[model samples]
Target chain A: MEKVLQINNLSKNYGNIRAIEDVSFEVKKGEVYGLLGPNGSGKTTTLAVIMGILNANGGSYEWFEQPFSKLSRRRIGALIETPNFYPYLTLWENLKIVAKIKDADEKDINNALGIANLLKRKHTNFGHLSLGMKQRMSLASVLIGNPEVLVLDEPTNGLDPEGFAEVRNIILSQADAGKTIIIASHILDEVEKVCSHVAILKSGDLIANGRVGELLSAEETVYIQTQKPEDLIKSLKESDLAKEVYSSDDDVAVVLNTDLNSGDLNKFCFEKGFTLTKIQVRKQSLEDQFLQLVK
Target chain B: MKKLFNLEKIKALSYPPFKTLMIIHFLLFFLVILVVSRIHFSIPGFSVKGLYQFPNIWEFFPWVASWFNIFLTIVLITLVGNEFSFKTFRQNVIDGLDRNDLIKGKLILIFTIAVYTFIMVLIAVLIFGLIFGISLLF
Candidate 1:
């Protein structure tokens, strides 16, 4: 797939504090890329730099191979932080202003509002809407031009479960429609669900980056049950290769510390006179991977 | 420019605060005229050095309207302040509206307000001009 957005070692600083340092990543066309990190970990800053909202101290970015020019930005949409609208204005009026600013068609205003699930509330005053509705209206403003790429920071933050679910559905559907999406969110489960690729940032540096499944699944843990659980624990302890070894009821949870084969662990346990009754290998989740990288 | 103008008008009309302000300002403009006309009745026209010193009720209208213009300017600046102090402008940037678009949108709003205010005041001036002239005849 062609690269839609590329950041080449972008950096930003606020006085002596570096918000982002040497951050580099590529968001491929039609892919949902997640920038997974904790709060104040440069997610918003990086987005600001990429979107040309804040001037970068170093490095460069390109949108659709056009070197972050004004023309290139026209095809991009972003919501880096909390967006606000006139509370006293109707939803339709707010978006009409946005569409006009972007030089987009006024006729497409209703379509954008509908996609945000706010068509019925188009005539309602913005101040009277719920938080989730306000968020959706903000999103509708960005979606007015039907841009090819979207950069969003915490798209589902401050939302209820239902609102989060709605945002997730909208993101997934947009990805399916061949739009490239870049989301920076603390909701790891949401990222795992919707993102094809991910970059983990910690304290202004990118420590881990790759496909969402591979970066996470590389560190699977195995659960073993045996009558000779004691002997199995002793063997694992002697090897010093198990990241975590604990017993829960009749089973033992053995996390692999190195890139060792699961079959080998089973074989090693069997050779040590332990009968492996059951073995369950679970894939490592995004949250676990994120913690490991940041830690 | 036309697109931006239409959008600015829609936003101003849709928002209750600005709409309310429009009405209040219109009334205030007429109120100034009424109060000045009332005071002009008791003033005596006097002649000094072969020159007529007429009680000019309309002389104060321009000063009142100019003060109103200053108030309008403050209100306009408040609109921009609302976006920044509330962080909505930053949010608009995130929502994919480009920087140029935002600047253009603001310019359009200011231009629209200037034009609307100028036209409204001009019409008021024309109406008052006829009224004051007819009163002199009677």
Candidate 2:
């Protein structure tokens, strides 16, 4: 796969404090890559550095396998942190400004607005719109040039549930069209549904990165209650059935190996003469996985 | 260059404050000159009309306009300050403009405004000079 972006050990600092340090990731063509992290975890800082809004303190990044340049910048449309448009300009006029910057045709303005569902409010000033509408307008601006890649930071910041679903649909449709996307968001469900791959960040470090299913959903943890919890845990650890065995309150928490399911572990426990009083299978939600990783 | 100019044009022209300040600047310049022209000196050695006549009007109009240059400065500052306050400068880069392109766009705006004021003062001088000079001939 062709690489759309490559960041190697990128670092950034704000005066005495380090915002992001030694962070790195790659986004390939047509891949919906998500930068997932909690608030103040350097998601916005990473995007800003790549977008040239802030200079990196150390290391570097490249677009399309070359050094970042104006031409490459035109190929990517980005919305970072907030919707920063001329508050006084009408939605149409503000998008027109973006169109001009990207050397896109004026006709694109309408198409972009239509896609964002802001066509009816085109003549309204940006400052006058509701916060959700402003976010949609930012999405509209990102679509102005019909760029090959889109970089969005908290794209659904102020949206209602319907608007949130609308933004997700737009992102999915864009991904379906084979446009590479890099989204920085703390919304785990959003990233889980929209991103093909993810890089999890914690306090400016790339803690984990890979396919969503493999990184977050591959493991299923089963909690079992037996007469002798410590003995069951010891037996499970001794056997090849469990990858990890620990106690969660009164129950024994077991993460079964890839080849073994909860059923296999149950059968093995029965064979070992352990009477299971309670057997519960739980799939870790993305939120749970995200919290665990960040924690 | 043309693209940046177009962008700046859309931003500035649509802004109400930009338009309002510009109009005020224009009116204040003309008002000062018009009011000063009306003052009649009792001293025999001096007359305000002399300042409005042919050769004098060229220098006099621009010098009078210079005092109001402060207003133009305010206008320029407002435009640039809005970019920072709104954080649109950062957005502009993310939208595809280079950092130098931003400075260039402001420079273009400044040049355009300079040209506008130059023409405005020139026309004002020409009209006032011909009106006063022709009257003196009679």
Top lDDT prediction, candidate number: 2
TM-score of 1: 0.83
Cα lDDT over the full model 1? 0.78
DockQ for all candidate structures vs. native: 0.43, 0.84
Worst 10 residues of 1 chain A by lDDT: A240-249
Output the number of the DockQ-best candidate: 2
Error of 2 at B134 (Å): 0.9
Residue A92 C-alpha lDDT in model 2: 91
What stretches of model 1 exceed 4 Å from their correct place? A222-259, A266-280, B40-59, B92-121, B134-138
Model 2: pairs clashing at backbone N, Cα or C within 3 Å: none
Candidate 1 is graded, for docking, as: acceptable
Weakest lDDT window of 10 consecutive positions for candidate 2 chain A: A286-295
Poorest 10 consecutive residues by lDDT, candidate 1 chain B? B46-55
